[model samples]
Target: MEIQHHVSLKHYNTFGLDITASELATIEHENDISILSEVPDFSTQSLLVLGGGSNVLFSGDYAGLVLKNNILGKEVLKQNEEFVWVRLGAGENWHQVVLWSIENGWGGIENLSLIPGTVGAAPMQNIGAYGVELSSVFEYLEAFELKTGKIAQFNTTDCDFGYRYSVFKGPLKQQFIITRVILKLSKHPTFNTSYGAVAQTLEEMGVEQLTIKDISSAVIKIRQSKLPDPAVIGNAGSFFKNPIVANETLNNLKTEYTNIPSYAFDNSYSKIPAGWLIEQCQWKGYRKGSIGVHAKQALVLVNYGGAKGRELVDLSKQIQASVQSRFGIELIPEVNIV
Candidate 1:
């Protein structure tokens, strides 16, 4: 564990905010956690842990220690005829894991290709795309508890997984740092191509015998067409979670806006596409100064070059206010603001 002082965090987050941290430390090994706790004044300093930094926004310079989780490894723990259990280090890139699974002929995560962030953040956000979620493949996770300096295991049930959420994002927020993830991948996969433009994109690709690679490529194409690359610009994929409303609520809105789009979340609720909602309010491509909503995808907010986290936050608020005022639905942020 190496700790540095007065570090610029511009390279740590997807938004590329140029903020400084009073101290920054890198945990490269599981033992590093114990070593970190033994550092001088480690107990009193406020801690901010970062993974791939894809889902985080730094509002300002951090006044405490920023721990960058870079613990990396990937291994197959066990396998049966039907399923294979893989152990991934927390700091491993999530998309790489998907690619690894594909390379090995593992089937389940093909629809989740190209989503950014690290494996540690995957379960915390319960990252989903093209109708597949981390919870579907998740077996369990091993978290390093800061308070006890001990490793604890949490299964899917313990995670309390939901849409863009888990126990780590709720009751256990910031209390423990995830160090490892165990995924249960299928040998024979059932493809989910109906969500969003996956099916249409697959058809466009002229796929006859559908394979995991084909689905992964299709999803990648669709996402690349819609979402902006954070490396080229600056963005946190989707800024807000798609809001779920009651059947009656959607029906009431349908009376006014006949073109309103929705999907069945369950029997009682409907999931309204957040991008559609934002676009209808005309916030898509709405740029001001440095920060603005992406033209290609309204759900994404971008920092042109030198935009701060505050500016993007303000723009998101404006978009939310407009969407809420127009449709009676609240837009909740999926990204974590620090």
Candidate 2:
């Protein structure tokens, strides 16, 4: 394994934040894990396992080792009459995996098309889009334990998936480096086009007979129309997770603003769209220097050109404070701030 010092992280992260890592190592294969764990500073210093760098913001220069996961492979492990079990390396691009599934007639992850990140990061966030989530198709995953240098497999039950949350971001945080993800995908397509603009986009595209490919195409279209590409505009996708509030709170907010949109979370709670709240707070299209709320989608925080991660962090905090002050809802960032 080659370890480079004072590595510029500008190209590593999708946000285009200019930051430096004290030591950076690239893990291209599973064998590299043994070598990396043997580094003298590996256990002594702080560590970050970066995938596609789509879901993180560096507050400043990192004073530790940054391991970039580049492990890549995809294979079918088993198959049944109804489903196909496939395993993929953590480093594979998520959208490409979705496309590969669609091409092979696997139908479970079609609604998740166009999401930016690596497969390894998907389970960490329980990534969801258009009424479907990673938990819906997850089978299990193999992770390399940092302390023991042993591989551990976790099933769906072990993950403890919640809205934009998983054990990888909780109790198991920084404890394991996910090496591979095993997914159970459907041989028969179950179409989910109910959320957001998916159905409308499908209609616009004249998709009368729905297929998994069509659903993926519709999702891609909707996402392209709403979210800005990180390559063109520096961003980490939806900066905040949609906050779930009590039913009573929704009713009270509804009394004042009847058009306040929400989805039923459960028996006593409703999930409010953070984007709507941010827009209502008048932050949408609001720019100050290089940092701003995305004009098209307020849920996304963007770095226009030369904005630092700290500036974006401050902007997100301001948005949260404004939302809480206005609607009594505290928006929590989905993006990991380091």
Candidate 3:
């Protein structure tokens, strides 16, 4: 473990906002966390378990310890003709892991390629893309309870994954730090290309006989062309989650705005595209001072250099208010505002 004091968090988070942590430490191995309880100062200071920091917004200097989970490894735990169980350390870069699996001829995570964040945070948000979510491949996870300093393992059912939520974000919130995740992937893969622009992108590219690597490459290209790289412009990719509404509510909205885009979620509910709502309010190219919505993806709020976290939060609120006023729908922010 390497510890530092008075650390700047600008580089840690995708938002590139200037924030400070009172103390910061990096745990390079998963087992290293077992001894964290003996670090002497944890009980006295609040701690933050951080992965890639792609999903968080630090509103101000953290008056606590920021423990960056740097443990890294990937292993095939079990394999057979039909399926394989793979385990990943908490700190692995998510996209790198996807690429690794695809290169190894594994198929489950191909559609989820190019999502920003760490593997540990994947189960927490139920991170999904191109029509597949972490839940589809989830097997189990090992986490360390913060209070008791004990390790616990949870199965898929224990995760309680729904949409973009999980037990890790609710009943288990802040109580544990995920150290490893186990995922089950197929030996003979089934492709998932049902989500937005995937089939279209493939058709446009005149592709057939698609392999996992090809699908991942397609997603990577599409994402690169649309989303601004956080390395170039500061942003936490989609800032707000698409809100789900009752079927009747969606019908009413559609009656008023004929072009409203929605997808059915069973007979009772429909998921509304938050990006469309934000764009409907003409917020795509909207800007206020140092913060603004990304021109291409209205759901992504960007830091136009030198923006404070507070400014970003205020801008997000403004968009939320505008969308609610215009559409009678509440847009919930996806970024974890700290």
What TM-score, computed on C-alpha atoms, does each candidate reach? 0.97, 0.98, 0.97
| Candidates' C-alpha lDDT | 0.90, 0.93, 0.89
For model 2, name the residue pairs that clash.
none
Best by TM-score: 2
Please write out the lDDT profile of model 1 over residues 71-167, one tens digit for every residue: 8999999999999999999999989999999999998889889998888888998999888888989999999998888999999999999999999
Worst 10 residues of 3 by lDDT: 28-37
**Model 3 Cα RMSD, Å?**
1.2
Model 1 alpha-carbon drift over 4 Å, by segment: none
Best lDDT among the predictions, by candidate number:
2
Compute the lDDT of residue 226 as modeled in candidate 3. 90
**Runs off by more than 4 Å, candidate 3:** none
How much is 6 displaced in model 3, in angstroms?
Answer: 0.5
Error of 3 at 69 (Å): 0.7
lDDT of 2 by residue, 1-338 (tens): 78999999999999999999998999988789888888776787899999989999998889999999999999999999999999999999999999999999999999999999899999999999899999999999999999999999999899999999999899999999999999999998788877758888888899887899999988888888888999999999999999999999999999999999999999999999999999999999999999998888999999999889889989999999999999989899999999
For candidate 3, write residues 1-338 as lDDT tens digits: 66799999999999999999998889887567767778787677788999989999988889998989887889999999989899999999999999888878888999999998899999998998878899999999999987888889999899999888999888988888999999998878888888768877877777878887778878888888999999988999989999999999988988889989888877899999899999989999888788888988998999989999998888888889999898888898888888
TM-score of 3: 0.97
Ranking by TM-score: 2, 1, 3
